[model samples]
Target: MLPGEFVAFIAALMAVNALGVDLMLPALADIGRQLGVTTANHRQWIITAYMLGFGAGQLVYGPLADRFGRRPILLVTLLGFVAASIFAASSQTFAALLGARVLQGLMSASTRVLAVAIVRDQFSGRQMARTLSVAQMIFFLVPIMAPTLGQLLLVTLGPWRYIFYALACFAAFVLAWSFIRLGETLPVERRRALSLHTLAHAYRLTLTNRFSLGYAVAASMTFGGIIAFVSSAQQIFVDEFGAGDRFTYLFAACAFSMGIASFANSRLVERLGTRLISQAAVLALIALSVAHIAVILSGVETLWSYMAFQALSMTCIGLCGSNFGAMAMEPVGQIAGTASSIQGFITSVGAVIVGSLIGQSYNGTTLPLAIGYLGIGLAVLTVVLVVEQGKLFHARQAA
Candidate 1:
């Protein structure tokens, strides 16, 4: 395969990672309405349930992938995802739908962690960073059109469940693709022993290693912050700010801007290094969070301001995000799957706490959203500062 073709394949697989998350965005309201979800607040749980499942299940995938290999594990999980998507499509009750969605999220997470592990198996340092950057840059197009696609599917097909049916189709394709094209990245000779003793040690070492945790935390928070926004964005924009379909497009614009940052990082990561660029980007996110807070305090609550500050924060996140994952997994090449699973677990734990808070706190305006952003930004930056050992590294180092 040409380099370009491989990149496309990776990007397509990566896009599947977002399917369970992004495709359901526009349906938040419909699901809530259809299920008679009385509380406007509880509606976000439809999304969060999936996240919680995805995040929690990540731990299992890494261990399995490390022990078994990426191809077989992903093959199993992707099939499970297809079945879960089918269950999600057939559900009428809120509990049933949420349960299926949670399973879908958990299963999809295996795919995601494996994709990262697959990268770690074949590349490291700058090469890994560059590959992940290209993959992420291309894959982000999923979120851009996801909500709009949801809306269109909802409007044209006349049932919100059809959205899951569409997701099932995508999952089926991924299942077939993996079986045909994915060889075992972690060969048996290289596989980690699937023992509780070794697994415990890996978790302990991952949590204790400053460099690994630093990069992992940086990656986690970057993603955690975005999850906060995603959980709240549709309501904040469509209900509070009134952008409707444009909200999806606006969110995509911010994502595309971040894609530009990731692309640029891909080109320079080998030259400058991951540690330097990630530190700088996190600092930028902190500043943007502060700016977002100011917008809320300025006595004006408007859609334009929300979009502006949100875009800024996300751009910084995009810049630093991929490198953090690459760096965290670089040293764990032999156990990349297990390591990637640990990485996902920690990140998801953070997201569940931080993201759940942000999603549940919306009070019919952008103020709560802005405040949440500011708070999370401060917390993440504090983690960075401490992890980086009392100073910020602002150099344009390569990954």
Candidate 2:
């Protein structure tokens, strides 16, 4: 594929994961009602279940991709995702739906792993970060539009299950696209053996490397805040603020801010360096979260105030995410698939656990989310400090 097409394809692959989550946001309430679920918090399990599976499944895909090459592994996973989506659409019970969602997540895990690995196979250091930011800038459009699309489907189609069908169709299209156009980026000479010893060594290298592990943890903490917001967004908008059908648009605005920030980061990363840019973003996020918490505590918070704080916070997150992921993978280029998998596992599972706490702590207000963001920002700063040995805003020349 050409450079532009390659970036767009990467974005499309990553967007499948976003579509799975965001497309379900507007339908959470409807799904709850149809499935006989009464408690608002209980509905969060729909998203959480998928994340849990997605996280754990990464462990397997990384090693497989390293051994089998990216093309075949990705194609297989896309097929699995389509089947899982169909299974989800056919669910009659809440438990069954959650099961199908977990399966969907497991299949979807390959997208995250392979996208990062494929990028790593071709680029490194700041260039890799720049590429990821550009891809994310494009990928973020899915979140920007998915909830509104979900709402439209619900309004016109009159069922939540159609969302799953829609997802399945999209996955099938992607699968066909990959079959026709996606080429193997990993060379045979670079392929790792699929064995217990090799897997253990690759994972150990990923886990023991200070920059790799620390940045992974830091990214996970920062991402937890994003996940928390996503988990509680429907309730905060529809029930708390009475945004009703307008919630989708409000959510889209926050996503749009992230996309804009991602585009800016893509332009700035090569010059500023990932370490300098991401460290600054972490500090900014902390400060913003502090202000956001104070506003919520003062009882002066409104829909617009929440939106402003969230959009700014997400922009900082957008800056941090691509840079952090690039840094984490930098020292593990030889084992990119394994390293990406480990990081993906950490971020997805850790974020889900953290996010679920904040989501469940909802007391008909935004305090939990505000406080959650502050805690995440602080935690991320702490991790970065230890990892960088108290060095902040230090820029390294691009490789």
Give the per-residue lDDT digits (tens) of candidate 1, residues 36-101: 898888888877888889889998998888787778888888899889999999998999988997
Q: Candidate 2 residues 1-399, lDDT tens each?
A: 999999999999999999988898999998999999989899999998999999999989999999999999999999999999999999999999999999999999999999999999999988899999999999999999999999999989988999999999999988998999999999999999999999899989999998899988888887778788888899999999999889999999998999998999999988878887788887888898889889988989999999999999999998899888998999999999988999999988988888888889999998888888888888888898898888787765552
| TM-scores, all models, native as reference | 0.95, 0.99
Q: What is each predicted model's overall lDDT from 0 to 1?
A: 0.79, 0.91
List the pairs of residues colliding in candidate 1: 62-337, 62-338, 269-398, 269-399, 272-397, 272-398, 273-397, 273-398, 274-398, 274-399
User: After superposition on all CA atoms, how large is the RMSD of candidate 1?
Assistant: 1.9
**Residue 337 displacement (Å), model 1:** 1.1
Assess candidate 1 and give its TM-score to the true structure. 0.95
Clashes (N, CA, C under 3 Å) per candidate? 10, 0
Worst 10 residues of 1 by lDDT: 390-399
